[model samples]
Target: MVRGACTLTAERADTDRVLDALPGLWQGFSATLIRDCRLRFRRRSELANPLIFFALVVTLFPLGLAPDSTLLSGIAPGLLWVAALLAVLLSLDGLFRDDFDDGTLEQLLLAPQPAGVLVLAKIVAHWLTTGLPLALASPLLGIMLSLPGHSMGILMSTLLLGSATLSLVGAIGAALTVGLRRGGVLLSLLILPLYTPVLIFGAGTVRLAVEGAPLAPWLALMGAMLALSLLAAPWAAAAALKLSLDG
Candidate 1:
C-alpha cells in the first residue's frame, strides 16, 4: 500500500512540474519562432522562393497530368492542396537542420526554459515559414489548377488550419531525425505516413464541396487533428530533441 501511494505521489509531482512549465515553455517557444522567422526572412529572395517553387510545382501538374480544364477543375482542389502539403513537407527538414548543424539546437535545449516550450517555438517558426506561405499562395495555385473561385476560399481555409497541424507533427519527426547524418530522407519516411490523415481531410474538405456534400464533418475532423497535434506534438518534439542531445 505504501509503495503504491509513493508511486502515485511521484507521478503527481512530475505532472505538476509539466503543468508548471507550460507557460514559460509557450513563451520560449514563441520567442524562438520569432527569431527563426527573422533569420529566415533576412534573405528576402530566399524566403520568397518557396512561394515561387510551390507555384511552379502546381503549374507543372496540369501540364504533366492533363491540359483539359474540365478534368483539371474536377481534380484541382485535391491536386493543388496536396501539392501544397508536399511543398511544406519538402521544406520541413530545414526547420531543425540548420539549428542542429550550427549548434543553436543545443543552446535551445540548455536554456533555462523547459525544452517543450523551446520545441513549440521552433514549430511556430516552422509554421510561419512554410505553412503560412502555403496557405497564402494556395489560392493562386488553386486558380492555376482550375479550382472554382468559390472552392478557392475553402481551399485556403483548410490549408491554413491543416498546415498548422502538419508543422507540429513534422517537427517531432524532424527533431527525432535531426542528429542523423542523412536525416532528410529518413524524416520523410517517418513523417509522410503520419501526414496522410491530414491530407485526406484537407483534400476531402474540398472534394466534398466539389461533389456538393456537407463539409462539416471533414472540417471538424481537421480541426480535431489540429487541436490534438497542437496539444501533444510539442512535448514529443521536446523529448526527441532531448534524446538527440543526449546522443
Candidate 2:
C-alpha cells in the first residue's frame, strides 16, 4: 500500500513540476521576443536608412529601363515590387549577423527559452525593420512605377502581407548561412528560389488589380504562403541555428 502511494506521489510531483514550468517557459519566450523587437526599433536610424537606398534603386529603374510612359506604366508595378523584395533581401543578413558577431546568438541558444522562439523573435524584428518600412513606402513607389491610383490599396496590401513572409522565409537562409565568411551570395542563392512564390503572388495581386481580376484568389494564396512560412520557417531556422552552433 505504501509503495503504491509513493509511486502516485512521484507521478503527481512530476506533473506539478511540468505545469509550473510552463508559465516560466512562456514568460522567457515572451521576453526574448519583446527584447528583439525593442532593440530593433531603438536602432531605427540605422534600419530606416535602407529605405533611402531602396528608393534610389527604384529611381534608377526609369533611367535604365525605357522612359516611355506606356512601357513604364505596364512594367512599373512588377519592377518596383521586385525591387522592394530585393531590397528586403539585401538587408536580411543584418538580422542575425550582428547577434552572431557579438556572440549574443550563442547566449540566446543557451537561454531557457527554446531556440525556435529566439529565431522567431529575430524574424519578427526583421519584419518590423525591413517589411514594415517597405509596406509604408510602397505607395510612393507605386506612383513612381506608374501604378494607377485605384490600385494603390492593392499594391500596398500585397506588399505588406508578402514582405512579412519574405522577412520570415529569408531569415531561415540568413540564419543558416550567418556564420559563413562568404554567406551573402549563398544566402541569396538559397533563399531566392523560396522567395519566388511570394514574388509571384505579390506581383500577381497587383497585376490582377491592373486588369480588374478578382482579388480573392491572389490574396488567398498570399495569406496561405504567409501563414505557412510563419509556422514553419522558425522551426527550420532554429534547427539550422542549432546545427551551426554545434559545428
How well is each residue in 179-221 modelled by candidate 1, as lDDT tens digits?
Answer: 8888889988999999999988898898777777888888889
Q: Candidate 2, after superposition: displacement of residue 158 in Å?
A: 0.8
Estimate, for each residue in 133-220, the C-alpha lDDT of model 2 and write its tens digit. 8888888987877778899889889988999999889989988898788889999999999999888888878888988888998898
**Candidate 1 ranges with C-alpha deviation above 4 Å:** 1-27
Specify the poorest-scoring 10-residue window by lDDT in model 1.
20-29
The pairs that clash in candidate 2 are none
Q: Tell me the whole-model lDDT of each prediction, alpha carbons only.
A: 0.83, 0.84
Each candidate structure's count of clashing pairs: 2, 0
Q: What is the TM-score (0 to 1) of candidate 2?
A: 0.87
Q: After aligning candidate 2 to the native by TM-score, how far in Å is the CA of 246 from where it should be? A: 1.9
Candidate 2 Cα outliers beyond 4 Å, as residue runs: 1-19, 22-26
